[model samples]
Target: MTGRITFWFDFASTYSYLSVMRIGGLAAARGISVSWKPFLLGPVFAAQGWNTSPFNLFPAKGRYMWRDLERICAARGLSFCRPDSFPQNGLLAARLALAAAEEDRIAAFTQAVFQAQFGQGADIADERVLQGCLRVSGLAPGLVQRALDPAIKSALRAQTDEAIAMGIFGAPSFTSGAELFWGDDRLEQALDHAAAVTI
Candidate 1:
């Protein structure tokens, strides 16, 4: 009963950043295979009648999230800097990720983009940033071009729609069959459940 853990993540979410850099080693030890599924949270918010992040909609939660992000990053010995744009554009990043998905470069693509946005304060929507991330992964410059093809673009959109239908209201979601867990905090529990099923 070894289950593959589907890691549903969004680029703009602070908690997702935490999960991205840290989930790999832990899952490796637990014998959990991680499938990085990047999606856009913008449509998720749009469908809920919101135009911005919940953090921005509610200032108090937003403030606490920033502070929490700092402490979490510090504990992990990772740098933290909130991007100027509350919810940075993730469409390009997510599509690129899906493109990389074809080559098993999802992990590298995820790491580079996360670091670019959350680690170095770079803009994810910028073609330069997106290409830079890919170059580091040895992905060809035309990769984004190929990812932008009509077929691939539709697939990415369908992926996001599927995420919304799956009851995912937040980023860094994890799912195994009928079990769905949201947040980086639930990562370990999700792994435990995956392991117990096989045992």
Candidate 2:
């Protein structure tokens, strides 16, 4: 059986960066389609009484995460840098991604934004950086302005709300049918689940 998996990620999520860079090729080999679903972690965190990422709320976990990301990236031959902000503002980036989704440019834009933030330490919230991402993704730079539209903003909010309703509390989560898998590490398992399901 062949099926698709929804990849729910937040721009500010480091592990999400890893998953985003690798999911395409992996899923393709397994004959599984991927749906890139970008959402905000802010409301999710807020609902749990936290204003910041768990990495920031808990110091030890935060430190380990950075080191862990470094090792993972190194192993994968992907560049890695620690952004000044633990969890950067992903609002604009998420909005842009949703806008790009209409034109099937979400993959390009999403990767560019993630690389800009986690690979180069660029601030994803910076308009200039986002404009650059749009250009790099072969999309019109004007799309950046479109990302600010009320509709795009609402779409992002709706997506986030959907994520919450789906019981997604973290980024880089994957879902195949009713099976939910969280974290970059679970990517293969999610794909396997999708591939094994009877159509």
Identify the leading candidate in terms of TM-score: 2
Return the clash pairs for model 1, or none: none
The best candidate in terms of lDDT:
2
Per-candidate Cα lDDT values, in order, are: 0.87, 0.92
* Candidate 2 structure quality by residue, lDDT tens digits, 55-94: 9999999999999999999999999989998789989899
Clashing pairs in 2: none
Candidate 1, residue 15: how far the Cα is off, in Å: 1.0
Worst 10 residues of 2 by lDDT: 138-147
Every model: Cα RMSD to truth:
1.4, 1.0
The alpha-carbon lDDT assigned to residue 56 of candidate 2 equals 90
TM-score of 1: 0.95
Name the regions of candidate 2 deviating beyond 4 angstroms: none
Model 2 RMSD vs true structure: 1.0
TM-scores for every predicted model = 0.95, 0.97
Candidate 2 colliding pairs, count = 0
Q: Residue by residue across 1-199, what tens digits does model 1's lDDT show?
A: 4557889999788899999998888888888788888888888989999999999999999999999899989999988877888788888888888999899999988898999898888899899999999999878889988778787788878878989889999998988876889998899998888777653
